[model samples]
Target: MNSPGTVHDWVFDAIGTRWTVTTPSPLSRPVLDEVRAEIDRIDLAWSRFRDDSTVAEMARAAGRYPIEESDQPLVDWYRRLYSLTRGAVSPLVGQTLADAGYDADYSLRPAPQVSGVPAWDEVIAGHDGTLELREAALLDVGAAGKGFAADRVAEIVARVTDDFVVDAGGDMVVSPRTRPLRVALEHPMDPTKAIGVVTLDGGAICASASNRRVWADWHHIVDPRTASPVREVLATWVIAPSAMEADGLATALFFTPAAFLRGDFDHHAQGFHHVTIRRNGSVEHTAIPGLELFL
Candidate 1:
């Protein structure tokens, strides 16, 4: 539903999710066209649900695959996430997810004998402009792809207006003009309730929750080490300079501790801030400038 409110909000569907773009004024036709093209490019390169996507091609063949320069940054970020999470988050887990019934068809029926994910070093090697897959392996980039697309759209919007908000699903990038944007953090167990609120001056915020996608006894967040769903964390939210980083960190917090990530990113000028809710109902959050929790 595209509506023109006081802020000029446009909502649409893309990449298997909804998106909303808000600007000081209406977006130009050229900007919208470019945004759509960029989204299509991202979906073609990273979507595992499509048969003709680049990831699907890698799943069918094992060899050196060339990729666009624009795609290289995401590959690098995935490598960083893999190392930071100690292999808990891996692109090679696509087959494991499919075997557990989260395949392209969304079968939701686990295979009788699910296979373990191959080691990162064993399955693939990264090089400039290309990746060498040792064997056929399905790669899933859903973790950060949506956020990257959001950032890309924000870049397009910035070309026209300096102040805008690009929201791809729940991953958002904000460029405020004067005051900060107030964001409600939705409760993991109940969408109608808000657990907290954030005052985002600028940059990006992303969230991940186990309760968002579930079927039977399983959820979308699977532990690659055991080839099963993770039950430790209920939800996580991250605020960073980039939506891609925020999105990846939101998932990484599920597999790793916040302290480790905090220590690593502390060197930055405005380091990332995060909020975590464990399955035991305990909440952990950093004392940052923009976060406020009801509990």
Candidate 2:
């Protein structure tokens, strides 16, 4: 599957992010169409910005809402992350983000005083193939939804070719191949400069940064405890077996220490690594096999 000399690529926008798909040969039209549909399905289920989205319905009123069976796993993963991070990373952060100005209209203006985000246990629960909400609460899966979508698209691409890479924004899933691919680790403050590089044969890599979306002394990565932007960690990148896992872990690293993740986060069984940049101008990384840093 290592036909490095011949590469076929497709680039487009999906789920509010840029995406690219590369393979040894061009995929069939049907396969490409399936990939697009798969992504759209995910957006429809999870997007908070859309009035007709399932999440928006949850936000508007409390009730038992049924979702597609495929979407249950994503909701379960968010539940796991909420428990693992002790509520630091939560789908309940949707209201927190909007109050801080990452709203549906892209309004970056902070409310005078933001309201507190609800706890997962108190607000939401799963009941007989449906999500039961105790009250109207905005849910946000931006932490890992894109990665989950990427993994789903890769599944479609995998049917056509074993050799491919699906990149959704910075979250990527690379199929196994004889030769490795080199990826640059972009600097949080300067996109033109890279803090490091990674040579990868297969698997997924996802990044999260405080620099991507910014407002008045606030950023997208918020601390649910305070409903304020996180200031300690500037950015993080994670590598794991699945893009969903990698993406969630990238955001988790911002709230928890690397040492804690290495010991407790179950991605250890499947193997994972990370690189972190702190707000105080310090850098840290695990002993990742193919990582090289110039910092």
Candidate 3:
């Protein structure tokens, strides 16, 4: 459902998830189709499930390989995130996750216990667009790819209309012209009930939860150091200038505490705001002057 000032919403499927675009007015079918294609491009490049994707190819190589210039943005972002989190959220955790039977199939069946995960330092990234992997590790971009795609979709939407909300699954880039968009944070433990409702005007919002993609004791987001599922925080919401940053920050908050996030994520200049809901149903949030969290 749209909030006050929106005209209608367009819903479809992409990137292995549903995508909806809420706008003040309906967009042309051609523009909508273009948006779909753009999102699909991101999936084709980063999806680990696909046999031909760049990420899958990198995983298969397990050795020194040159990355495409087009993929440099993703590599740079990951490197920054790795440094910021102090390896709490590493791209190398993908191998550990796959070894633990959390492969693209999504069977969620428990696999043999993983011993340890590789470090981001081991995978040498060069400024010349080359990535040399010292050992084998799957590079998972699931953390920020969808949100990045959402931003790209929003960019496309902005071309036609100034007011729109591009939601790629739970990662959203909302640009509201008339009024604020009402966004509800679903209970991480119980999806049926919402924990809070917040207003999003002209920024991106992404939520990371341990329960959304869980089966057994394992979930989608895995800590690189421990090679285990995150448990302390049930969910985290991040609002940032771009959906890509917001999405990665949401996952990073799972592994790293919120207090340390400001400095690590350059929250000052970027105007980053976060809300964390722990396993005990407690909340910790940065005090944004006008934003209200209705719990």
lDDT of all the models against the reference? 0.87, 0.87, 0.78
Instruction: Show pairs that collide, candidate 3.
Output: none
lDDT of 2 by residue, 159-232 (tens): 88898999988899999977888989999999889999997789999999999998898899988988888889
TM-score on alpha carbons, each prediction: 0.95, 0.95, 0.89
Q: Write the per-residue lDDT of candidate 1 for residues 1-295, one digit (tens) a residue.
A: 4444457888999998899998867898888899999999999988999999989999999999887888788888898999999998888889988888889999999898888988899988764689899888899987788888898899889989887899888899999646888998989999999999998889999999999878878888888899998999999999998999999999999999987776678525435788999989899887656688887
Candidate 1 vs candidate 3, TM-score winner? 1
**Candidate order by decreasing lDDT:** 1, 2, 3
Clashing pairs in 1: none
C-alpha lDDT (0 to 100) for residue 75 of candidate 2: 80
Deviation of model 3 at 166, angstroms? 0.3
| Model 3 stretches with alpha carbons more than 4 Å out | 1-6, 62-71, 134-136, 176-178, 264-271, 289-295
In terms of lDDT, the poorest run of 10 residues in model 1 is 262-271
